[model samples]
Target: KEILLLLVADMKAEYIPPREDVIMQNESPDELYIIVSGEVEMLESEMENEQTVWTFKSGDMIGEVGAFCCRPQSYTYRTKTLSQLLKIRTSNLIEAMKTRQEDNIIMIKNFLQHHKKLKGLRLGDLLHGVGGDYGDPNMYVNLLTVASTGNAT
Candidate 1:
């Protein structure tokens, strides 16, 4: 909670209307948005004949991958309703996580917690997000297989 408190202290709370784009595909992702209330969608362009799209609600954080890694955004995020989003720049979040270390260490758990149970919008209605966003069931199954069996098939 220390990390979240620190981040929220520096984060900006905004009321976003429907159809507003928070992050665009292929853009340099500098900030991460946390859905405070309402819904957002993560959409990716077609890749290997499969496109991934996910509907995320409150408590979901989007764009952390690109924000933290400084990679091109793999997906675009758009608000679906009058959503309340907590926006924080990557630098600020990093700063929050980098508090004085000698006394205590910080752990930001579930910072990227995606509600896999929340319905998926693509890949034959399969829950395909936050599993590397590959949009392939076989890929996810293989990962699970390797994870459980300790060997790749």
Candidate 2:
């Protein structure tokens, strides 16, 4: 993926052996990691317990929010296999986002829609405020409208 490659180029590369634990739950670190090769597991911990959340493969982006918000990592990341990663510091990503405002806007819009859907919000209701057909084009228009209104949807 071109975007992945571009982001990776902005990061520091590292090779990790299989079964290596990369991030710990609740640990504060502001960095985004791109998987260049192999696999990673995202996990959650509660009351001294750990649970797997998802598995990420090559080209997958990890730690986006932690990087953007400069917050503690909410999940733990572990190497499922021999993994190569490109680690982008939060400051660099923030600068990149600033330089690419359009990309950031689009990404945020998509993320919001996806998050709403995941939370069981109906597509119709999500588009109700915009009063338009629900489609990719309409989604962009809604995003633009929300942006113009100084309210990012």
Candidate 3:
């Protein structure tokens, strides 16, 4: 099963040029972009203030929660330099996963892991309570489990 997923069909990739003053702080729009190459900076916005949260590189997935939930974006990401990305529409990803069950399962696992890592960081930030920091790690884990089991709602 793992081998089958490793051999699954690959998606097309796209390239983006560097831009100045890119807003890395905005609500998520539920889109997933797999970083094929280049760099991106993640930022969070609160009360007219923006802070750099993280930097993503190749093989990293962005906007997983939004892609899963079909909700507003929770963070903002901007290219730190010229970048190449595989833009996977959430609807298309969901459909493809349905067709390729094994591969879909692997993808779901990867998404869940990424979600957990992000959720942990966000939860820690919330504990500090210096910003509009609010997140539920358990809820995210539950969502992933439900979605992967084909019981998402």
- Give the winner by TM-score: 3
Q: Whole-model lDDT, candidate 3? A: 0.62
Collision pairs in model 2: none
* lDDT (Cα, tens digit) per residue for candidate 1, span 4-114: 678778889999999898987777768888889999887765654424377778887887756544456767788888899988998887687677442122222232123
Instruction: Per model, state how many residue pairs clash.
Output: 0, 0, 4
Q: How well is each residue in 16-134 modelled by candidate 3, as lDDT tens digits? A: 78743332334544357888888877767698887877787898777665666554555667888898887766666676667667677677777667656764365223222222444
Q: Give the TM-score of candidate 1.
A: 0.64
TM-score between model 3 and native? 0.68
Local accuracy of candidate 2 as per-residue lDDT tens digits, 1-153: 444455656879999998888876656666778899999997766888877767778977666645543445657789999999988877766666565657666656654554354344333332322233323435544544575345873
**Clashes (candidate 1):** 0
Q: Among these predicted structures, which one has the highest lDDT?
A: 2
lDDT of each structure?
Answer: 0.64, 0.64, 0.62
Quote model 2's TM-score.
0.64
Clash pairs, model 3 backbone: 27-73, 28-72, 28-73, 28-74
